[model samples]
Target: MAEHVLEMKNVTMQFGGVVAVNDLSLEVNKGEIVSLIGPNGAGKTTAFNVVTGVYAPTNGAVYFNGKHIVENYPRGKMKKLYAGTSRGVYTKHIEPTPDVITKLGIARTFQNIRLWKSQTVFTNVLIAKHMRRTSNIFTATFRLNRKEEKKQREETEELLKILGLYEVRDELCTSLPYGLQRRLEIARALATNPSLLLLDEPAAGMNPQETAELTDFIRKIRDDFHLTVFMIEHHMDLVMDISDRIYVLNFGALIAQGTPEEIQKNPKVISAYLGEQE
Candidate 1:
């Protein structure tokens, strides 16, 4: 059996009266490029936020590499507002911060470009390595972490060179063209040494050519680094061309999931994206 790198078991995220993700369950196996695609406000990003610890799920659990990273049961005032299918299934609560999630081999990029505008391209990537640093603040402040710091810098330089950003390492992050900025964000995520990379709309603002290049880049990274990719994308061309499997969402609920060929022919997916015919 394939080892599941990530799994969501009856996961639900609710806010007051709104159920953002309702009993959503899915899994991405090791070394697979799985996609979650859907229409606007389908709760895709909400599910991503739930996985990365940005939000505590109202019900159910999330497992990463066979370990439970997030598990919760709705309680308190939420009991009255909870409208999900699985409310009492989760008996324990486990909510870690986003940084903690990153340390556990998960890294993500936002739907919007979030590069540090003031920093250089190189600095942006280097900062992501801080999460894995073993030295204490005192050692870092006193420059006693020279060995570790040097190692990190060396790794950063190699990563930039490999990702084709070495030439513009000193360029201001915001000054780069939109495509490069997106690449930089992904590169920063890679610097965190993540085994699982979650990209939210990686091709959001790209032209066809750039999107095509991104398709190749994603496959290259997944193969070269032995990483599992879970992305939320709307670009059907990219999703169809590159994904090992695809899951479709509607109204925060999973509507369909299968291989790209299967999804392309799924009537429910067609209805969700194109609406009913007269």
Candidate 2:
């Protein structure tokens, strides 16, 4: 059996009185491509946000690699204002920061392209490498650590080449085609050297041909990087073609989960799609 990299147990989130997610539980094993599919307001992105620490779950727990990540930080004004709270009181339970999460082996891309629009393609990726670099900016600015700088540059160039962005490395990100821009975002995420990658709607605006190519590209990257991939995508064909497992969400809850073939035949999925047949 493959090792589980992430686990969510009875996770629920409520915005005031309305529940966004209800007792959601899922797992992604190592080296697997898992796709989360749901209707527009199924709380898919909210689930991602909870897992990535953008929002704390109102109830339940989240575990990554066997460590409990839920409640890593204290909540409420008492904790924030340091009103009689001891320093390091929550230190033992504190989860690592987002940067630490990336460093510890998880990385993600947003639904929208979040690239450095004015920067060169290479620079966009280079910025992600900043997290992994050991040298201080002062040393880099003064050229005091030429070796570390050269190493980082080499790493960036290699990532560009791997993602097929080397030819356009000098171009401004905003000037690239929409497809290339998406690829750049994935490349930037890869630059973090994550063991698990989260991609959000990677084929949102691409033409069919571009989406087809993206399917292959995602597969190749998975194999090459040896990373576990969990994505939320609306493109059914892409999701069915690439994912090893599929999780179906509807109205902020998981309705079905199985192999692609199994999910394709699920009545819940059919109903969720409102009887849209493949």
Candidate 3:
């Protein structure tokens, strides 16, 4: 069986009487493309935030590459707001910082493009590559890491070429069109050398033609990098076209999980998203 690159075990996230994710569980296997889809308030982005370690899950465990990256249980101020059944027991709590999460073979792009607007496209990508550098601060301070820097630059250049961003490598990141900027965010995540890539609304703000290009781009990158991709997207065409499996969410709860054809036929998914009537 293919190894699961990511696993969320009965995870729940809540905030002050508001539950964003409730008893959510899913898995993304190696080399597969999976998607999470729902309406705006279905907690899709919150789930990404929890997985990426932006917010600690109120309960349950998250594993990446077979490592327990984020594990949570109710405590002090959170006991009443855990939104799951883990309360009133011995609960383990461990929430790694976002940067720490990035170094552990998983990387993510935000729903909003988060490039360094003032930095050039090449510089932005190169900065992300620094996360994996081996040189010490002292070595970098004395300009003794020239070889390492050169290699990083070379790799970033090659990545830009592969992602079709080399033509604008010297432009300010904010200067690129919206679609290209989104691609740049994906490239930045790839710079972290991740085995798993998480994309939040990668198709947002894209026209049909641009979305089509992005669909092809995503497929090309997966094949080129041998990556496992999990994304949250509202574009039904894009999600159905590229996903090997999909999970649908409604009001922060999972309504269905299946292949595209099965999900399309699932009455729960159809009723939630398509508003199908008898």
Please give each candidate's TM-score. 0.99, 0.88, 0.96
Question: Best candidate, lDDT-wise?
Answer: 1
Q: Rate the local accuracy (lDDT) of all candidates.
A: 0.96, 0.84, 0.91
Error of 3 at 166 (Å): 1.0
Task: Estimate, for each residue in 122-216, the C-alpha lDDT of model 3 and write its tens digit.
Answer: 99999999999989989989999999999999999999998999999999999999999999999999999998899999999999999999999
Off by over 4 Å in 3: 86-90, 274-278
- Tell me the tens digit of each residue's lDDT in model 2 across 231-254: 999999999999999999898888
Give me the candidate number with maximum TM-score: 1
Question: By how many angstroms RMSD does model 2 differ from the true structure?
Answer: 5.5
Pairing residues by index, what is the TM-score of model 1? Answer: 0.99
- Of 1 and 3, which scores higher on TM-score? 1
Q: Distance from true position, residue 215, model 2, in Å?
A: 0.4
Off by over 4 Å in 1: none
Q: Which ten residues in a row have the lowest lDDT in candidate 1?
A: 81-90
Residue pairs clashing in model 1 are none
- Better candidate number, 2 or 3, judged by lDDT: 3
